[model samples]
Target chain A: MCAELIFYSVVPSEEPGERAEIETFLLRNGLSYDEGIEIFVVGREGRKLVACGGLEQNIVKCVATDPLYRGEHLSLTIVDKVIHLAYERGHSHLFLYTRPNNIAFFAGCGFYPIVEVPGLVTLLENSPIGIRRYCDGLSKSRQPGARIGAAVLNANPFTRGHRYLIEKAAESCDWLHVFVVAEDASLFPYCDRFQLMKSGIEGIARVTLHPGSQYMISRATFSCYFFKEKNVAGDCFTAVDLLVFRQWIAPALGITHRFVGTEPFCRTTGKYNEDMKYWLQADLSAAKPVTVVEIPRIESHDRAISASEVRRLLGTNDFDRIAELVPQTTYDLLSSKYRMKAVGSHTSATA
Target chain B: MKIIKDAMAGTLESSDVLVKVSPSDGPLEVVVKSEVERQFGEQIRRVVADTLARLTINEGVVIVEDKGALDCTIRARLQAAVLRGGAVEGLDWSILQ
Candidate 1:
């Protein structure tokens, strides 16, 4: 039966019918087609789509095998093909999101469980000790303090509001660990955002700037953070991200508090802020709960200073207005780097 | 032979083993996940270590996912992965035995 099965790849954009076929196959298997998936490897036993798997960046999703083909091990063929595809694309470290019940199946394929949000979702990585290795590396930078504070920020261009949040968080705790979100999905790339953050938060005592990892607010942990649409499953991804932070990240550094700036403009961000409190503090069953601290957003002319507003100003080439919203370092970098490009194109600043 | 890049070989089918080799800054680390780990875990590790020793590869991460594959299959997969990983500067056809 296995020898008779044929496998093929499908690019969703190129083959809409085949993509819909895979999506329908996934739906029948209790899985939905993720919009983020780029390529899918489907196993067919004489025109019957018996098994299917997808690769979205480095993460594998929407893997399913027909119930009739249970003993044929068709899932392995799909996974093997998907993994080869990922390696060809230079993605060595791979992740998979599966149901809790399917952990053993993926584990058999050499993917170990990283984090699980109960029955909602389970994240698995190719390496068994990947999360352990990340946490171990983090332990080397572990600071000595009783009241260790932490904050995760994208800091797209590092506004004054971000500076204020860091300063306030640092003042409240003995030491502060500020992780700049490393995903390059924002208007500003990660290096620029990281540099802007480094310069913006300079001269602040007892503050350590750390680069974000997949265990942090990354695409693997929370895809919704990068997307504009409000997904119902966003809450689930948020929980998984927060859980990874609480279970592995905070424990590695002995962090006691998590800080964030108040979000008044974006409803999604504001809801995330509300969810943080529930996940980080109220829902702790055994581990020590990290206190969620929300500082009011810094205002400029009665308007809350946000990276989005700075971006909007940059689109319009309003350096004067952007200068008011962002710090000196951010303003300098933005104006110097984007001044020429902003003249002809404003689409890049739209985020 | 040094693993200069990431490479993979073999499949996840029955009686087969999938091997992935990547350059590592740390020491040579071989991770084996097999269905028969309890019975052949140590033997699998020994085969992987011996294979790396034969290739004179001292620094890399070798991951082997076995689906009831024989020792010869594991060796073949690891060799293919190492060769594909661009550790072919010094040809050692004799050591492949």
Candidate 2:
């Protein structure tokens, strides 16, 4: 039961009007309602619903809360009840689809990503005509300071380029949240990857790390909107990715200006820049377009240093070559028992 | 306290919950020791059942040590612990026939 200021009740009804709203919401989400199943939650004050997840047969679908009353863990309370009801009714498994952005919130409540259909995500991200918002931040009324976020996947090794990009984003924004992508497909585990980024950016005041666990970059990227190569060739992937970055990912993170490197030699990096330039020129009138900064590629004997280059050198067991590409500290990490072969190998090894 | 020790030994020992089946008519006892000391047996049980049902868990006993957990907090934490405890580890639903 919720306190007086908090609401605690579920209204079960077959009324046509109420059913219509629920049905409409479900239809919009491409889900259907079963006859025996019911929808319920304990609502809070200010028309804030404590939880409004649906129970179809045994599956628990769509756990949601009022944006205003988040962080209080009210949805968890209601979900607990729903889960209990499901078990008592002898249901097999609870399943629900949360926007990839909110995956961690559900993960914190013990839901794991069972299956991922990249197609469903592409459909969601590509159509930005009427899609107002894809995620609810900490607040409904956007704070001026809340307008900034850093979309980062520690992919583990934090390269100088990554450090520079994050540093630049922090300098430009009031608050920069560095999200570490949280899928297990990668070689470096989430914890190590998160630690690498956190420590790599350690003294930066505005920078904070969030686990990309279920909802962050991996989901968005796997959906092809982040990479945007579904319709286009490999050459145009960067452009499509940039469009999705601007339209879908940027808004959710409350970011207006994305800071990217101006390294034209790096294929993906260059693609991101090119796409960003196009998006800024074509679409960004209301918001500031992505700010592309040319991070002077670290040079060792006139050769430009990069993560891929470092990984290639390390693959050959060439410590000297790797040392030249990365910082002394990074060399120590790479030479250690934990020499990374994954995303952050370049950064972590060099850091 | 039929504390189902070692039931979760191999898989869940490294994780959270061990092996939770369905709650039988055996009073389904749950003992929660919290420093805050809020008497939440009835509602806690409800959350346990609800979360288990939602997760499609059939039966099990759950004993939680509360560190200032509310109703929802208790449920989420319990669900996490149970899932982590290896009850569903490596059980891929897509392959489930």
* Candidate 2 per-residue C-alpha lDDT over A186-233 given as tens digits, one digit per residue, 9 for 90 to 100: 444667656667767777777666655323333334333223224334
Native interface contact recovery, model 2: 0.00
Give the alpha carbon lDDT tens digit for every residue of A1-351 in model 1.
Answer: 344778888999899999999989987986777888889889988888899888888888888899887754677777888898889878888988776888888887778888777766677898887888788778888889899999999887788889899999999999999998876677778999889899999989999899988877778887542232244356675777888888889999999999988887777677778888888887654557889998998788999888877777887899888878888888888888987675432122111
| RMSD of each predicted structure | 3.0, 17.4
Error of model 1, residue A337, in angstroms = 1.9
Worst 10 residues of 1 chain A by lDDT: A342-351
Off by over 4 Å in 2: A1-134, A137-156, A183-187, A213-216, A223-249, A279-281, A284-296, A327-329, A338-351, B1-97
lDDT of 1 by residue, B6-96 (tens): 8899888888999988887788878888888999999999998998899888997888999889999999998999999955776778988
Give DockQ per model, in order. Answer: 0.74, 0.02
Model 1 DockQ, alpha carbons vs. true complex: 0.74
Evaluate residue A116 in candidate 2 and report its C-alpha lDDT on the 0 to 100 scale: 32
lDDT of 1 at B17: 93
